[model samples]
Target: MNELSDNEALMMESLARGIAVRAMKDHGAVPPTVLIGNENTVIEYASEALADAAAKDRLAQIARLLATANDATVVTTILESWARIAKVPGGPMTERIEAVMIMTEHRLGSRALLLKIERTEHGKFRRLTPVSVPGLDSVQGRFTGLIPPRSPSPEEIKQARTVLGLLGLSPDGKTIRHDLN
Candidate 1:
């Protein structure tokens, strides 16, 4: 993807900040930052800035938008319209798209999966976890070392389910089915 120019980055950041502010005011909670790009559209929202009740409500609103978005263009259009409504300056469309793609593909957020490391009781170290997100067909044994030792926290599990859901995987997390027909 194309790199974002300094001006474009500033514009995009401004637009995101504006949207977040508006969303916060309307719902009484800060909304997620949206990144738009081909194959990389995503909304990374943190709701803690507002009151606890407001934050949950705002997060739910953000999640709805994210869960329903199916394409990058749609996401960009939505953000552009939001900016216009909020009177925020818009960024270069192409740069926004590219940034979105990079963000989504890399999963750049607090929830993004970082490197997986494993330590054994015998002081041995192993790094056999797959770098890619797991699919339905991905065997549990392949990720035995990667899966969290205890059940994932609700938020973490929710994020995982969302990612898997975006990839069209089953909620059960057993296997991947590509047949959309």
Candidate 2:
């Protein structure tokens, strides 16, 4: 598949918002203007009631409270209160609630990349850093031993020959030749 373009990304964002709205409607959630924003773009879900000064003020207060919270637990607590105030019902609201819970959960390790720095003994010049590849965790059992062996069928061999031809491989499979003058 091809990579997603900017327009496709926007369309996907719209689809997600539509699904959220539908879920909210199904669960009888009070309709609040849903807003999705990034550093560059801001998309608003229009609602007549959300235009009120009191509602806007409350939203601002909630936003301020969230901004003050540095820890995940505090942030989750603030989000939960905000969701309650917004009158979010079951389905999509449940998803939002779970998201908040995940945000608050303890992470197993740091997501940031680690860097190692080295300095010369003479202190004349220093190199920036080097990175080591992380090792893969070991799996529990040997599942391959339990599985059955299989051989290529006639159709598979035919398809393989077609692919080889496309790659300019000889039909007899004797040698590989490169185009040259």
Write down the TM-score of every candidate: 0.25, 0.20
Instruction: Tell me the spans in candidate 2 whose CA falls farther than 4 Å from its real position.
Output: 1-19, 28-30, 33-51, 71-181
Off by over 4 Å in 1: 1-4, 38-163, 166-181
Clashes of each: 7, 0
Per-residue lDDT of model 2, residues 86-158, tens digit only: 1232223232111110011111211111122223575422332223223211111211011112233556446
Model 1, 3: alpha-carbon shift in Å? 8.6
Which is the leading candidate under lDDT? 1
The residue-by-residue lDDT of candidate 1 on 120-173, one tens digit each, is 575343331222333312222211122132334567656756775665543332
The Cα RMSD of model 1 versus the native structure comes to 21.1
lDDT, residue 181, model 1: 88
Error of 2 at 169 (Å): 69
Superposition TM-score, candidate 1 onto the true structure: 0.25
